[model samples]
Target: MLNKTLVPQSVARKIQGMIQTGEFQSGDKIPSQREFSQQLGVSRASLREALLTLETLGLLETETGRGTFVVGGKPSSSSHMASWRYSDSYSAFDVFQTRIMLEGRITSLAAGRLAASQLDQMENLTQQMEECWARQDLLSNVEADLEFHAIIASSCSNAMLRSLYQMVREQISETQRHPIPITEPARMRASIAEHRRIIAALRAHDGLLAQREMENHILNTARCAGLAP
Candidate 1:
């Protein structure tokens, strides 16, 4: 008997059938998540999960600003799994590379300038992240991770830089998703530790060290995500 928990797989097979039957031919853009979920009577989360599987099977390819496209091929059981939630306009590598450049400088500028409230907020968020990690709750952890960086962006004293970073924030969130290898517990703990290091540098008012720490953290993250050397 099939497992009751295989909801996404069931959705995947249905979409696969549509591909096989030529309803969604090669090079065709599949329906949007909202449309698919509505048509299939399933949640958007489940549909997204199914699309990630299809992307791994090479039955679909997500393109920049082009939506998800059908490749019309058999699903490969051995294909690697990764998040398909990234921005279509920018690859994960592109987003993180930009982040490393911007955030490293931002952290440097924020050093010695952060208000007590800001530091307290960051400390609270970091604690929340650690607690979430202990509970194995990745989603909440990712939220706190984003918030921590956002606070640093706010502290940078550069309104334009903050605006630019905000523009790509969603793309940044995508990099935290699965198949990047950082989702593993050890890597997640390492990430939390890196956060602490950045915090320490900020507390010390050491601009250069803060910048270096932020850069190193981002580089390590990119490496774990398979986006950088």
Candidate 2:
């Protein structure tokens, strides 16, 4: 039965709890709305509401002729390309290529239009990155790293370009989750320094130099992470 006090909580939270407890797993069929209503002592309407909430959050996928399925939650390159009718699977290189195109335009636009305040913002984010690296805060380093790049892209005067970069931001973040081994400390330091240089180029409205520095920074990161030749 539903607790009187806990009833104040949203239905989505209760359903989220069920998923976390492994009441259902990937590819497992969830109970019907009627069954859930009886088990949880809630109305059928409440149970349906909960299911819709879960569906909206990407927790379940429904097929036309079949019931909903609990697809795995782990994100991957192939997972994002499920809608693509490919003769073969997409590769990490495909994603890198797209990033190169997307970020290249963003850097070029940012270079032409960055304001003094935006330069200061990039500098601050880059400084945070250096501190995180020196302290060996690997996760923080990754977050700050992404944020600094994101800040640069967002500062670009072109709204459409900024939106496109934000759309693929999650994919880029996921792909960059590799461990930064301490064996190559110089790579990280050089990457951080390049960020400052790129900011200076943008502040000067030097489009070519800013674009080149930004491209070199990403390529160097890929190489350091052993994702490049």
Best by TM-score: 1
Question: In candidate 1, which residue ranges exceed 4 Å CA deviation?
Answer: 1-81, 178-182
TM-score of each: 0.64, 0.57
Sequence-dependent TM-score of model 2: 0.57
Tens digits of per-residue lDDT, candidate 2, 1-229, equal 3633124225555665555567777778777768867887887776665554345334555666777666533222113222211215544555566676778678988886766877787788888878875754444556677777877787777899888887777566544443243215567678889898898888888888888887777777666444562
Candidates' C-alpha lDDT: 0.75, 0.63
Model 1: C-alpha RMSD to truth? 10.3
lDDT of 1 by residue, 138-224 (tens): 345656787899899988878888888888775765565443222456776787899889999999999999999999998888886
Q: Which model scores highest in lDDT?
A: 1
